[model samples]
Target: MTIFLALVVGGLFGFVLDRIGVTNPSIMGRMHALMNLAVMKTILLAIGVGSILMFGGQMVGLVDVGHMSVKTAYIGVFVGGLLLGTGWAVSGYCPGTGLSSAAGGRRDALYFIAGGLLGAAAYMVTYPSVKAMGLLEKIGGGKVTIGTVPGSGYDGLTGLPGDVLGIVLGLVFVVVAFALPERPRKGEPVPVAAE
Candidate 1:
């Protein structure tokens, strides 16, 4: 049942991603170039809505606090994030978008997936050495959230109440997403592939 639910949810998510034109590498490239804001706006809106729902549910005891997990901050995490961003900008696909694009029949996306798997395999092969170097060690002693939630187990970086902070941030994101211009900047050349 859990696997079935996962497949259903994953399929729906991929469908939505494809419908939003994110499956197109050119659209993603234009977003990185700052010539288009559609992808950024879409991402921000999704984040805003997700944050509101998750935090609000937690506050109301609808969300299972016991099931929530936060990754501990560490130097390797920052390095990994930088690498991931670089890959996303260069390939125009993050893991989720890459899979969605592949499912949509993009050949380049298949290559991206292959490269990602190779990277992951390399990481696995080097895991022992990486762990010995202390790269896997958690920094700051423990896991943390950006805001305080009374029973969430994560120590908050900020003193603000978690749900309140989440809602405020979510609203800000939503506002910024709405304020962003949807049209490409004047004089920017549209890619032939995107058309």
Candidate 2:
């Protein structure tokens, strides 16, 4: 039942991605180049709203903290994030977008997916050596949060309430999304919307 629900939710999410034109690599490229900001705004808005709902739900006892899984901080995580950012900029598709694009009949996204699978395989092959190099060593206390939440077992780096902090950050993201312009400059050519 859980798997079925996940499939349904994932399919809906992918449909939303396609509708938003994120399945188009050109749209993603323009986003990275700062020639188009609709994607960025949409992403920011989604994150902001999601954060608010999640944290607020937790505070109201509607959401359980047990469902949260925070990855332990390590050097490798940061390195991987940099690599992912570079890949997104170069390929114009991140993992989720790549999958959605492929579903939407994009040939380029299939290539991106293949490359990602190869990269993952390479990582698996090198995992033993990478671990030996201490890149996976936990830092700043494993599985720590930025702020404390009542009833949550994870350690917090600060005394502030996690729910409050989350809501504040969400509000900030929402404001920034609204404040951002379509193009950085007035004279720049308007990017062609894929849909």
Best by lDDT: 2
TM-score of 1: 0.88
List residue ranges in candidate 2 displaced over 4 A: 188-195
Q: Compute the lDDT of residue 95 as modeled in candidate 1.
A: 92
lDDT of 2 by residue, 60-88 (tens): 99999787777799998899899999999
For candidate 2, give the lDDT of residue 112. Answer: 96
- Against the true structure, what is each candidate's TM-score? 0.88, 0.91
Question: Distance (Å) between predicted and true CA of 49, model 2?
Answer: 0.3
Where does candidate 1 stray beyond 4 Å? 140-142, 183-185, 188-195
Best candidate, TM-score: 2
